[model samples]
Target: MRAMVIEENGGPEVLRPSEVPDPVPGPGEVVVDVTARGVNFIDIYQRSGLYEVPLPFVPGMEAAGVVTAVGEGVEDLSAGQRVGWAMAPGAYAERAAVKASLVVPVPDGVSDEQAAALLLQGMTAHSLTHSVHPVSEGETVLVHAAAGGTGLLLTQLAKARGARVIGTVSTEAKERIAREAGADEVVRYTETPVAEAVRELTGGEGVAAVYDGVGRDTFDAGLASLRPRGVLVLFGQSSGPVAPVDPQRLNAAGSVYLTRPSLAHFVADRQELLGRAGDLFSLLAQGRLDVRIGGRYPLADAGRAHTDLASRRTSGKLLLV
Candidate 1:
């Protein structure tokens, strides 16, 4: 199998396209003939040495494909079944072996490519909206990087829940994309103070919650944009990791709540994993959710994908197929 192997964690160019042994299923695992793989920020983190991984590893976390073989003790799924998985390492290959507990059935109406693009980002958005704070009707939310993969999905999900959305983007092109995703307003954060704009939009009252993935760059603004007791869900550190600060800062910032949530913790149980995927696929099948997949690279072009994502030049979901 041709896989994208990182000889060492450094630059995107460190990724090499090389022939590797095909994966074999172990007990309670399944080998997937990967059709598509989702490129995420965590892949960039791993490639850049921000997230530690053993040397010479394949770099991908989500993929959708056909089951080529199922290991012992796996009875519910069979060979040739359509499926997708998140949290599966080594997905930047033609094939990967993932635990059966991590694989989820692809709904009849969803395609392999779409499922691959949506799994990690979609579930992350679901956890942020439905699990982290569970946005309710008639509330408001501020979504940073609102044109990115999780941003678009989170915008739609927030709108679907009857919440008015304020989206921040760095470019004008993303303004249209965010608006299409049902954001009530879009701010070009590069040109204006987004926290002030959100306050202005809400008549001097901040939103119920702020979903911030851009950490250091947006942390100060996120705190100011929240109302008293508003929740700030810091899920990623795209700009940079936030520096440690006193917990009293939360109290100083209108008694706001700050949380750094991770998808792994939210879906630790198999039931939670399946439930989140099922809800995402159901929404996709019903045409209620629109997943915008912007880039697709072959497994060999993993370096270019990393470059684009790390440079913030890609939007929606970037896929390696």
Candidate 2:
């Protein structure tokens, strides 16, 4: 099997394409012939040594493919089934041995590429809007990086929940994209202060919640954009990790709530994973949620994908196909 192996943690150049041994299914696992793999910022963090992982590992967390083999004790899923999975490593290769419990059936209307693109980021958006803060009808919420993969999904989901969405982006192109995703207001953060724009959009009453995936650069603005007792869901650190803060700051900021969430914790069991993925697929099949595939690269071009995502020059999802 061909895989992009990270022999040593460094830059995107370190993701060397090499021939690796084919993955075989172990008990409770299934070997998938990957058709598409999702590229994410976490892969960049792992490759850059910001997030620690065992050396000589493949660098992907989500993929969609056909099941080539099924391991013992896996009765519900079988060989030849189409499936997708998230939060499972070794997806940067041609084949990945994913635990059967972690895999979800790719339904009739959704394609492999869409499945791969939506699993990690889609579920993250779902968890953020549905569980983390639970956006309510008529409530206003702020979404940072509204044109990006997760941000676009967050905007749509928040709108679906009937919340007025105020989105932050860096360019006119991104602002258009955010508006298309149903954002009631889009702010070019580079042109104006985000908190000020958000306040003006909300008539100075601040939003009910702020979904912030871009950390450090947008953290304080997100805190300031929230209404009293509003929640700030800091799910990713794309700009960089945030600095330590005093507890007094939260109190001073209208008793705002802060939470750092991960997809792993939200889908902690097979039932939860299936439920979330099923809902996302249903929305996709119904044409309610649009997934934009910004770029597609050959499996060997994993390094280039990382470079594009880190540059923040790309919108929507980047896929290795």
Candidate 3:
């Protein structure tokens, strides 16, 4: 199998394509003949040493493919079944050996690329809107990087829940994308203060919650963009890791709630994993959700995918095919 392996983390160049041994399924595991793999910011973090992992490891966390082999104790899933998984490491390869618990059935209508693209970002968006803060009807929320993969999905999900969405983007083009995703208001945060813009959009009331994936650069603005007792869900640190926050600051900022949630914690069990993925798949099958795939790289071009993502040059999802 040809895999993207990182012996030491530093930059995008560190992602080297090499021939590696094909994965073998252990007990309760299944080997997938990967057709597509999703490239995410977490992969960048791991490649850059911001999120530490064991050396000489494959870099992807999400992928969709046909099951080639099923290990002992795995009864529900069988060989040749189409499946997808998120938060399962070693996916940047031709085959991925995944725990049966992490694999979710890929519906008939969704393509392998779509399945790979939807699972991680889609479920993250779902968990953020439906669980982290639970957006309510007619309420307003703020989403940072509103044109990115998770951003667009999060915006649409929030709108579906009837929450008014205010999105922040770096360019006018992204503003248009955000609006298309159902954002009620879009602002170029590069030109204006994000908190001030959100406050003005909500008539100075701020929003019910702020879904922030760009940490450090957007942390303070996201916190300040919330109303009294409103929550700030910091799910990623694309810009950089946020510094240690002072709880006193939270008290002063209208008693705002702060949380850093991960997909792993949200889908700790098989039931929760399937539930989230199923909801996203249902929405996709019904044509209610539009997943924009910005780029597709061959396994050999995994390094370029990382470079583009880190530079914020791509919108929607990037996939390895």
In model 2, the runs with Cα more than 4 Å from the true position are none
Root-mean-square deviation of Cα positions for candidate 3 versus the true structure, in angstroms: 0.8
Give candidate 3 regions above 4 Å deviation.
Answer: none
Clashes of each: 0, 0, 0
Give the TM-scores of the predictions, in the order they appear.
Answer: 0.98, 0.99, 0.99
State in Å the error of residue 302, model 3.
0.7
User: What C-alpha lDDT, on a 0 to 100 scale, does residue 42 get in candidate 3?
Assistant: 95
Q: 1 or 2, which is superior by lDDT? A: 2
RMSD of 2: 0.6
Q: Residue by residue across 1-321, what tens digits does model 2's lDDT show?
A: 899999999988999999988988999999999999999999999999999999989989999999999999999899899999999999999999999999999999999999999999999999999999998999999999999999999999999999999999999999999999999999999999999988888889999998988999999999999889999899999999999989898899899899999999999988999999999999999999999999999999999999999999899999999
TM-score comparison, 1 vs 2, better candidate: 2
Which residue pairs collide in model 1, if any?
none
Query: Model 2 TM-score?
Result: 0.99
Winner by lDDT between candidate 3 and candidate 1: 3
